[model samples]
Target: MTVTLKDFYADWCGPCKTQDPILEDIQEDWGDRFQVEKVNVDEEQDVANEYQVRSLPTLIVENDDGVVERFVGVTQREDIEGALESAGA
Candidate 1:
């Protein structure tokens, strides 16, 4: 199945900045195993609203079956990895 990591963040959000490196590392490790879509809330309010993202850094893991995991704020590396693994990434 296709797995996707939807990262909802704004440029000015501090926690979002902190989450960036972690996501980058995950991308480096996972490569094409999954896809990461970064949504800038400031520029993409519609998309953010569609996801009902009420926080600065919201991470949503989805597969072909739909959303499997959702996290708010600055999430840990292992937590994200676990989510991806569960989603069949």
Candidate 2:
């Protein structure tokens, strides 16, 4: 099963910079078990709007089965892990 987390961010956002490393660590730790993809809001405005992402660091997680969950703002590792666990990651 594949678990994917997508981050919507812009280059000029300070919080996006802060959250980037955390997401990178999560990617490194999770490896192929899960993956993180980034979408630059400035570059992908339509996609961001489709996800209703109005913030700098919005995270949308989806499983291979197509179950999805959305989170706004800077999230913690534990919270992300818990969500994945709850989603049967």
Compare the candidates by lDDT and give the number of the best one. 1
Q: Write the residue-wise lDDT of candidate 1 on 1-89 in tens digits.
A: 99999999988899999999999999999999999999999999999999999997999999999999999999999999999999999
Clash tally, candidates in order: 0, 0
RMSD of each: 0.6, 1.5
> What's the CA RMSD of model 1 in angstroms?
0.6
Q: Return the TM-score for each candidate structure.
A: 0.97, 0.87
lDDT of 1: 0.96
Q: How does model 1 score by TM-score? A: 0.97
Error of 1 at 57 (Å): 0.3
